[model samples]
Target: MTAEHYFSAEPATPDQRGEIAFNVAGRDYRMTVASGVFSAGRLDPGTAVLLRKGDLPDAGTAGTFLDLGCGYGPIACVLASEAPRAVVHAVDVNSRARELTALNAEALGLAGRVRVAAPGEVPDDVSFDQIWSNPPTHVGKAELRALMERWLPRLAPGGVAWLVINRHLGGDSLHAWLVERGWQVERIASQKGFRVLRVAGKTD
Candidate 1:
């Protein structure tokens, strides 16, 4: 198998199924996973940090949320459960990831609330009330920046995004870059060498 890269549009690793369990917001979840998807073996550390550090939506939260680069739908499932009135779009480029996400959502009884779609399949006109991602940082600076540029602008007015990145992997530089672009970026928390950023819509 080619050296695995989660950002690869088509991962070459032979699919091998497994399961992972994580607790968040007082709930425990056991989700299915397989090779070729991001963190197929377990919930990734950056994602774990993001979920732990960022503000999860309240029970009364409404409107649509975007789980960008969702792997096996952990974030999406959590969001759906926390905000039952809201719709969640779980977007990923990897087909295996999408399939696994769908399966996990169904297993969690959240299939109706979580919509799994390929990145390009998200409706063009839908804006998100919140966006969450432990983005694919290994995609390189240019691609990573482009990915943010493409998605951040789609946030609804007054919306925000939560992201986590390894501190050694340009997290500080990315904070500066977003600030320069007029976004209000806050380093809400740093743990396990990961930086959790909360990004608000541009005011200027």
Candidate 2:
């Protein structure tokens, strides 16, 4: 299918390796990427903004953290690095993406801290203290909403989620949807047509 379909469970193309570099919280990260993952060639701008603006957990932070649509484990890696005591669960449907994320975690010597898995593989009893995502908005609005519906509730009470969505790609609409669903949604930051949303403390 199209290169835009990174969420496909099985990517049609062969894995072609690439690398990208970016900084988060004053630390630079260089990671291997490949076809079948999100943003194979470079750091995603929205993710960069999310990492730059979203609140990062400190070393004392514990409990599980979910990195939804983890790509090559950038978010997972950063979460593990920042909160060493926390368990980071990285979930993606793409097999190649999961493979690369696991590889990247091992390469970065974070394998013990990061757990890469398919969405269904995550234990039902598990909940997260924090969740982070640069969601696959191109997957269509219905799919995007379903994705959020599935995972957002996995956040523990008082837990927070950081999401980055392109403004033109229904960012505002998604914010409204989350609010309507009773999540306290805040537009924490914006850059390069992307909206960084901070979700926490549900309220009707």
Candidate 3:
């Protein structure tokens, strides 16, 4: 049997389901999680730091947003809740993760606004006003770079992306790489060994 990673397209592990609760931006969230997904036991530290340190949309915020690599929809749900007028596209490679994200969005009454899908399922015509991610660094540098290359270009003009990366896991190098790619990247916050980066298209 092949080993299962959280990035597995279809995890072979048993779906031992549970719930995780956390608060972000003064709002409490309880989400359903299962085995074979990323951070099935709790909110991931990088994700928590991203939500805490990154700038979140307010109620008045309106636009299409992407929560790339959404694991059970914590970031997607929060974005939908915070910006009721906005739509959040929660994309993940893991089928179980997509299922859990859909379930949690429905539970939180955010099913209408949170669009959970596999990476390929998002429409080609859609572009995002904002993108948020605590990307999977364990995927190796090449795969990680490919992920960015695949998605970062989907940002609408004037759009911004928020990302949190562990310092020990090439966070600084990623920032440098983005700059080299002609994107404007700034380290907006650093806490608990994670760096929150604000990235935007370069203006010349």
Candidate 4:
């Protein structure tokens, strides 16, 4: 049997499903999870820190948001709940993960606002006002860079992307690389060996 990887386009592992509960910004959430997805066991620590420290959109916020690499729609659910006026695009490579996200979004009554899709399925005309992710750094540097390269450019003018990466996994270096590439990167928070980066599109 092929040992399933979170990045697998099709996770061959038998679905071992689970549920994880968390509270963000005083809102409670219980979401479905399954094997062969990133951080399927719990709310990942880096994602926790990113949600805790990163700026979230408000109820009045009206714009498009992207939850890049959404595994089971936790961030997408939160964004849809908090910003009812906004639309959320949840993108992932794993089909199983996308399925779980769709289920979770419907369960949370957020299916109307949360659009779950494979990375390639999102419409090319859709641009994000804010992007949120705890990227899959285990995918290796070159692939990781390529993932970011493809999505980050879809940020609208003045858009911001919030990312949390393990410090041991080249967090600082990635921040530096963004700077070198003309992204205005800010180290918003550092905790539990993870760095939260706030990257703004460079305005000419």
Where is the poorest 10-residue window by lDDT in model 1?
1-10
Residue 154 lDDT in candidate 2 = 88
Predicted candidate 3 versus true structure: per-residue lDDT over 24-131, tens digit per residue? 999999988988999888999999999998899999999999999998899999999999999999999999999999999999999999999999999999999999
The runs of at least 3 residues in candidate 1 whose Cα sits more than 4 Å from the true structure, single-residue gaps closed, are 1-4
C-alpha TM-scores of all predictions: 0.96, 0.96, 0.97, 0.96
Model 2 reaches what TM-score against the true structure?
0.96
Checking candidate 4 for backbone clashes, the offending pairs are: none
- Best TM-score among the predictions, by candidate number: 3
Query: How many steric clashes between backbone atoms does each model show?
Result: 0, 0, 0, 0
Whole-model lDDT, candidate 1?
0.90
State the lDDT of candidate 4 residue by residue for 139-192, as single tens digits.
888988888899999999989999999999989989988898888999999999
Cα lDDT tens digits, model 1, 1-204, are: 232456677777778898999999899999998888888777889998898889999789999999999988889999998999999999999888889889999998999989999988998999999999988888778988999999999999989999998999989999999999999999999999999999999969
Cα shift from native, residue 103, model 1 (Å):
0.3
Candidate 4 local lDDT, residue 197: 97
lDDT of 2 by residue, 1-204 (tens): 365658889888888898888888988888999887788878888888998899999999988999999988899999999988999999999998999999989988899989999999999999999999999999889999999999999889889999999999999999999999999999999899999999996884
Q: Candidate 1 vs candidate 3: which has greater TM-score?
A: 3
Can you give the lDDT of residue 49 in candidate 4? 96
